[model samples]
Target: MVDQRLPLASVSDFATWEPVLRLMLTDGTHRSAGRSARVAGRVSRYGWSLGHQGSLSSTRIAVEDIQRSLARGGVQEVAFSAEIQPDGRTTLGLVWPSPVVEPAVGYPDLGVLVLAEGSLPEPWLRRPDPVPGAMPAPSADLELLERTLRERLPDAIGATEEEISAAEARLGVPLSDELKVLYRVTRVGRGDDFEAADRAGEAVGCELFGLEHLSAVDAAQRHPGWKLGAKRAVRTGPGAAVQGLAGSPGWTCFGSNGGDEFAVDLTPGPAGHVGQIILVDHEQSLGAELVADSLTDFVLGRLREDGGDRRGDQLPAEARVGTGHLETIQAAAHPALEVLSVGPGDGTPYSLAPVAGLPRLRTLTASPGTLADALEVAGLPGLEFLELGAREWRVLLDAGAVPRTLKAAAITVRDERHLPVVPLANEILTLWNRPRIVQTLLYGDLGPGV
Candidate 1:
């Protein structure tokens, strides 16, 4: 049934790819590359990028055709490969999206999804821990905030008691006194696009959402991919003002600044107020920035702001080695570590013994040839997500050392030859009895280049 949803036009048709191949061969490398050229690129609803191809003007039509085909097939992301033999014979390979491929439209690509369809990353499954030390900020004044709003916008209508109760019921969390008082002053009915924008800008620093628009900023609101989520851990520093979490149920969204949300933080950080405000940016996958100490501060032009750099070197829970964040695996090793990412470096492969048996470590990513011993991965018992080069994955597959604890995995493509990536991914998926990556290949001859 999944196959039925694919491009109705034959993906195996040589004609479908002939235009692109002809244009690719026009890149002035016909005598060298086109004579036996190998071309590859990823295309999807987002965009398309193909190297070793002709000018954009010449390739635009062909690229558009492929994208339209993907749209018809309802594919979010797809990669294609074309291998042209010296004899002019061409092999076109199309790697289609599957259930486990991760349908991420707007969410961040934190990591590649290697598990069954329903399995979410650890961060997406976390809830806000109780913050016993959190209390109301000193600036939180329900009386002042309401009085100021009423004076600033005397003509503005306010929400009824029933509307406030409805929002509380919908969010499953009671609004803080500051939040209740602020909303009571104005329910913010949508007045036309321009007027609504003006009203929100004048009332709040951002576009304020009405009572009906108030929603809970919870984990389900965000769907981060495996690469980033599995490679980073959510953590707040010792004196953080807002807890470092992917999302929280207690975060009641009230406004938006384009790609960010303004919320009341009920579960605040160690040095924060329970009724403080936080800004959750879309570009980030984890944690909120302390935008205002309290709603009163946020409204009365006394807003206090600070950056969320307390997590220190991208948070203690996540450690990246060899990619310039940290120098060695020894430096990255910590008892609280959860995500270990090893990137390509100039030096020789690093040993994994430093991170061996790390209690909380669950996710790992190692670039090609970056590990001195691929089999050392067996020592990480808590690994739930993994990504390694094809050769490294093969070593694990052949030695029967692949981590049994892995819920999902990926084979990092080292070069343009994606021909091996899917097969390796399928091999790993089969270990867990999951569906394999669907591949289609077409053969043709573009003929000797002009």
Candidate 2:
């Protein structure tokens, strides 16, 4: 067991600064050393002798690295054991109780941060090689798949062996040969153009999450009190309890259309085959079901099939008016239309009124300019999902017009520059208040934000 108590602190210092230190360590927003130094400086102000007042350089450096590692977004919790040297220097040994972020190279479980009295000694760093693991050889099928995908998407490039190894370490799971090959070839981050038809003739798009997404997802899964949202249940037998994977433990999601995913199962259930490809659908009554025997078959099948008609393209001509006309939405009385997307016909913002015509519309996706109009005019009696821009989200909040029937919402930000000037805390609090919406996704950064 690691000793959590900070060493060489007075009782007063312990009482006053321990909680602050813990908060600084666990808070995910402090990514840089400067931020960590600020927190350490605050602690020093609270009666702890971080070092001499005018010469706290060594203490600051050690504290900064410790806090930076702890604040790393994907880290769940950090534990530390501190040794107080006879000469008043301290060596703090650190470990992540459960790391969602991949540890820096050469440090697996242990890191060392040394603080000497009066001035700095050595700079803070991870101790080398605490734990080691074997690396798997890449398979031929994965190589072939990479070559094929690159042929189709000229810009596609595979992840390096080092990248793959890092991902596996972060995930704490071995990647199958198929996945190894795929990642090596194409590290897809934003996949809007990859479209395919599933066996059911549904127009499925593919956005195989890159390593970053995987790390984020892993962190969320490990977060305290996190639950799978709006997942469909699966039953194995007559008396068996229904099982629902908010996201399956053994399944690694490789690609997703809006509503469904193609995942590779590492641990097969009683009815499932190990290493089989499966389709996990949020809209399906059964939730997850088998799709193909292998990754090769799944890839080849999607490639061979013709892209099916998209639901958005099937709307009546009147419903598909050019973006300038908000009046068209109110006028078109299409009772049974299920999905609708509205964008500017011209580059200028398009305004809409509440559309009462499409009472049966289940899904609505619109640009920020048109969202207010859509919300105000749409009766949305059967609405299930909504997609809108970040600016539109603010509009809805201001109007307080989100429909009660909405099950999920995807709020897209085209670029980080478009993010509201509001603090992240306030933004999160507002979203948390919307309990009726079971799931919410904020996507898009234009490569500027994480």
Each prediction's whole-model lDDT (CA): 0.76, 0.41
- Cα displacement (Å) at residue 258, model 2: 1.7
Cα lDDT of candidate 1 equals 0.76
- State every prediction's TM-score relative to the real structure: 0.85, 0.29
What's the true lDDT of residue 137 in model 1? 87
Could you say which candidate leads in lDDT? 1
Could you tell me how far off, in angstroms, the CA of residue 31 lies in candidate 2 after the best superposition? 63
lDDT of 2 by residue, 121-166 (tens): 1111111111122222122255565566556656555578898888
* Stretches > 4 Å off in candidate 1: 1-10, 22-37, 52-54, 71-77, 103-113, 155-157, 160-162, 190-201, 307-311, 323-327, 447-450
For residues 67-124, write the lDDT of model 1, one tens digit per residue: 7776777767666777787777887777777776753333212125466667767888
At residue 118, candidate 2 shows an lDDT of 18
Give lDDT: candidate 1, residue 426.
73
